[model samples]
Target chain A: MLMEKSAVENGFIIDLSSIKNTSQLVFELSSIMEHPDVKGKNICLKLGSLDLKQSQLLSIKALIESMNAKIAFIDTKSEQTEASAVSLGIMIKEISSDLTADIAPSEEDFKDSEYKEEAVEERTENPVQDTNSQEIVEVHTEVHNNPIETTEGIEDIYDEVSAQELSEVIPSENYQPDGFGILAASEGLLPEETSKYILLDTGNVLPEGVEENSVNTESMQTLYINQTLRSGQTISYDGNVFIIGDAHPGSEIIAGGDITVWGILGGIAHAGCNGNITSKVRALKLNAIQLRIAGLYARRNDTLNVPYVQKTNEFTPEEALIEDGKIVIYKKLRRD
Target chain B: MTGRVIVITSGKGGVGKTTTSANIGTALAKSGYKVVLIDTDLGLRNLDLLLGLENRIVYTIVDVIEERCKLRQALVKDKKNPNLQLLAAAQTRDKTAVNAEQLKEICDTLKEENDFVLVDCPAGIEQGFQNAVAGASEAIVVTTPEMSAIRDADRIIGLLATKEEITSVKLLLNRVRPNLIKSNEMMSVDDVVGILEIPLVGIIPEDAGIITSTNKGEPIVNDENALAGKAYRNVAERILGEEVPFLDLDEPKGFMAKIKNAIAKLKVKV
Candidate 1:
C-alpha cells in the first residue's frame, strides 16, 4: 500500500516535470500527473548527476515555473532515485536533529511517507480520466515556449506520424523523389520546417530576391522554352519559349501563348498554353511533331529541319521570347 | 467493410503491371478480403488469361458498361477462391468503349459489397489507363528497375500529383534479381526508390515461378511457399495500413541457390 502511494506520487511528479523530449513521453507523464490524489501529495524530485543539455534544463525550468513547485538540483553520483530519496530523508533528519529533537516526534521522517501515502489513497479513489487532451495542450505549450527548437517531439499528433514527416521518412508517401518532405498538420510551418524544401530560403538554398514566378497569373503571358529541359528540371516563365529541354521527341509543352522551338522541340508544346495562347508554333529544329497553340493545331512537319543544338564546351542557356507577335531567340546574360 | 478501390497502373508497357495486379488480387483474396479484380485492359484483356479465368467470364465489363448485362451478371467468380471475383473486359472493344465516369460508377457499386476492388490498368497513358484509374482512391505503379520504366513511372506519378482528384499513389518494384543486385549488375530497390521517389509498396523478386504460373493461368501469389507470393501478400497488408517490412533484396543467397549456382559456376569455369 505504501509502495502504491509512492508510485502514484512519482507518476504525478513525472507528469508535472515537463522535461520530456518526446510528446509520447509527455503524454504518458501527463496522465499520471493530472491525477487529483497524486497532485495533493508532496512530490520529491531526485536530481542525480544527469548530464542534461540546455534544452532539457530549460524545459524542466519551464514546467517548474508553471507548476510553482519547489525544486533543488543536486549533483549526487547516485543513479537510484528511491535510494537517494531515502538518503535525503536521513540527511534532513541529521541536519535538523538537534533543533527538532526537543520538539514533536520527527515530522520530517513521517512527512515524506505521509505525502506518498496520501498520493496513493487519492489514486485508488479516483477513476481513470483521459489525459490525451491535456497532453496536446502541453505539446502546444512546449512548442510555444521554444519557438526555435526542432527535435524530438510529437513528430506527428496523429498516431505520431505527421503526414509531412511521413512524406519525408518514407519518400514514397509524398511521391517527390527530388528531395521533398511532408507537411503533416499543414499549419504552413511545414514549408519552414524542411530546409531542403525551402527552395527559396532567404540566405540559404536560393539566393535573396530570387522571386518564384507566378505561373497562374493572367499577366504571365507565355513560356518559350528553347533548350532541352532534362528530367527533374523545371522552368516557368511569364512569356513564350523558343525551344529546348529534352522535351523529348514525343513530349509537348504548354505555353500561355505562341511557342516556337528552335531545336527538335518534340513532345507536346502548347502555344497560348492553357488556351491563353494567341499561341502559335514555329520550330527551326522542328521534326514533324504534335503541336497545339490555343485551339489551333499544326501537324508534325517531317521535312522541318528544327536546328538541333549540338553540345559544345560552353554553358549556353538558349531561350526564346515573343516580341511584337514574332518569336525571338538568344542566350541569356549571366546574372553572376 | 466498405471496400477500397485500388488501381494498378504503369504508364509504359511491359512493366509487369498486369502480372502484379493479378498476384496482389490473389494474395488479398487469400487473406480473406472480399476481392474483385477488374480487367481494364479493354481489347488487350490479359488479366483473365493470367488467372486462367478467361473461359469462365460470360459477361465482360464491356457488356455491363454497354448495358448488355447487369454488373452482377458480368462478375466471374474465381474458381480458386470463393471470395474473389473478376470483371472481365471485352475482347472486341477499345479503351473508348468505356469512359472514366462509367468505370468510377462501376467501382462505387462494387465497393459497397466487396472489401477490395483491384483494377488492372491497361498499358499506355491513354484513355484506357485513365478509365481504370478514375475510380481508384489509391494507385500502385508497377515498374522494373530499368531507367525506361522508372522514367514512365515518374511521369505517371507527376500526373497523379497534379490531378486534384486522385489522392494517393505508390510504387511497386517487380522482377528484382538479387544475384544481379549483389554483383551491381541490376538496380537495387534503393536505386529505384531514389529515382521514382515514391513510398514503396513491394519489391517482388525475379522468380521463375511467376512465368510458370502465367503459362499455367495460375497466379504466382497462390503458391504458399513462393517468395513472390509472400511479397504480394506483404503488399496487400501494407494497403491495409500494416507496417510490413520490405524483403531484404540484397541479403546473401540462400543455401540451396548458392549450392546450385556454385555448380553452375563450376560448369562455366570448366
Candidate 2:
C-alpha cells in the first residue's frame, strides 16, 4: 500500500494506495488519527487507490466520526465507492487532478451540502456579483499559489452573502432607527456644505459642461547624487534629479522632470527633456552657462527683466522656469 | 622606529603641495627627527629645487626603483639640515616608470631608517596620484580657498578614503587671504574645513615671504619671523601628535608682536 500525507489549514490529508485488507486500512487510519499533528484537524482522505466494499466504506466513516472530527474524501472513479461515500453523509469533494482543486472548492459543491445552507441563502440575497467577483479574481490571480488566499476569497464571498441575507431575514417593522438620522445629517454636510464653499473660494472650478480630462500621469521617481559632479561627469535620469553637491562647469545633468541642487550649480542642466514644459530647475547658486527646459533655452547672458527688490552681483540662489515660451530666472525667496 | 609615510596630494595643480611638503619635512628635521622627502611628480620634479638640493642629485627615484642604484646612494642630503634628505624624481621619466608596488617597497625600506617620509604627489587623480598614495599611511590634502582647488581637494580626499593603507587624512588650507576672508569674499579656514570635513592640520596665510624663501632656495619654515613659517612648524608639531591651536589669521601678526611693534614706533617718535 502507498500512503502520502499533506497538511492544509486546520486539516490534514491521507492518500491511500492499493490497501490489501480491512485490517491494514484500520491500522493506518488509527495511526493517522492518533498523530499529534492530525489530532484536532479535519481529515481529507483520497480514495482513488482503495476500491472497497460498501460495508468497508461505512466502517471507515464511522471510525472517523468516533474521533470527534469531520472527514471529506475525493470520490473514486468507481460508482460503488462514490455512492457509498455520499450515502454515508460524508462530503465527496469534487475531484480534480490539479492540486489547486483542494483549495478552491466548486460553488455547486458548496450549495449541495446541508452544512452550507446559510452560504446559499446569503448568495441569493446579494445581487451585485459582477464587481465583487472581478475584485476576487484579481486578488486570486495575484496570489494564485497561496492556498490561504484561495480560502480567504471563498470566505469573503460567503461572508458578504451571509451578511446580506441576515439583514433581509429580520423584520423591517421591528427595526428601530438609532442615531441614523444624525449620521445622515453629518454625511449630508460633507460634499454639499464644505466642498461647495471650497470650490467657490478657488473661483477656478471647471464648468459643469466641461468634462474633466483623464490624463495618465506616472509617478515621478527622484535620483539623488550625494557627491559633486566634477568635470567630464554626466548624469541622466528618466525622472526628477536632486544633487546634494556642486555641479561644476564642465558637468551636465539631464532629467525628464524638475531638477533641484542643494549646492552651487554652474553646469549645463536640461530639465523636462521628455517635453514637460511645466518642469523647473532650482539651485542654491544659479550660475549655469546654459539652461534648457522642454524646447526653450536660456543663456547666462539673458538679463532677467523682472523688477527686483534686491539684486546681487554674485551668483545667488535662484529658480528657472518656463514663462511665455521662454526660460526665466527668479531669485528664490528665503523661507526663514 | 618605524616612521609614518605621509603623502601630500592635491587633485588640482598649483595648490602648494611641494611647498607644504618641503616646509613640513624641514620643520620635522629641525625638531631632531630624520626625515626623507620624495618627489613623486615624476616628469615634473620640483621638491629638490624647493629643498635647494637640485644640483647635488647623483641618482633619482626611478634609478632606485629600476634597481640601477642602491636606495641609500640615491638619497640627497639637505644642506640646511643634515637630518633631512631628498629623493628627487626623474625629470625625463613619466609616472609609468615607477609602479605602486615599487613605491611601496621603497617607502617600506625608507620607513625603517627615517622618522618620517613625505611624498609630494602630482596633480590629477591618475596613475601618478595612485603611485604616490600607494604606500602612504597618512595623507595631507592641500587646498586653496578657491572653488576649483577646493573641489579637486574634496575629490582627492574621497579617493584617499577608499585606500586601506591611509589611516588618516587632514586638510591644509594654503594661500588664504585674510582681508578677503574678513570681508566675506573668500572662504574662511572654517569654511574649507567644513566642506572637506577633515581635521585642519594648518592654514598658511597669503604671505609674500613664502615666494621669497622659494626664490632663495629655502623653506619658509626656516624663517622664524614669517607667519607662514610658524604655520608650517605648528603643522609639523601637530603631525607628531602634539595639540597646537590654530593661528589667528585676522591680525597681521601675533598680539604680543603687534603691541611690541607699536611700542617700538612710539619710542622712536619720542
Query: DockQ score of candidate 1?
Result: 0.02
Candidate-wise lDDT, in order: 0.54, 0.65
Q: DockQ for all models, in order? A: 0.02, 0.01
lDDT of 1 by residue, B1-270 (tens): 578998898888988988988888888888888999999987667787678665344468888987866898788787679888999887655788899999999999999999999999988888987898888888899999898988989988987776666788899998898888889998888999998878898988887667656755778787666787788889989988899998875653332331122110000000
| Candidate 2 per-residue C-alpha lDDT over A1-336 given as tens digits, one digit per residue, 9 for 90 to 100 | 001132122344565444556667764565345333343345667666466654466546545544544453444655777765543334455434454334333333323254246434545754653443333223323332232321333333223222212111111122223311110011123222111011111122222443322221136888999999875477899888999988875467888788898887766687777777777788887656456676554444211111111223444466776555445554432232
> Which regions of candidate 1 fall more than 4 Å away from where they truly are?
A1-336, B250-270
Once model 1 is optimally superposed onto the true structure by TM-score, how far is the C-alpha of residue A319 displaced, in angstroms?
A: 72
Docking class of 1: incorrect
What value does the lDDT take at residue A250 in candidate 1?
27
Candidate 1 per-residue lDDT over residues A229-272, each given as its tens digit: 54223343446665644455324355554555554444445455
The residue ranges of model 2 lying beyond 4 angstroms of the native Cα positions read A1-336, B253-270
What is candidate 2's CA lDDT for residue A139?
32
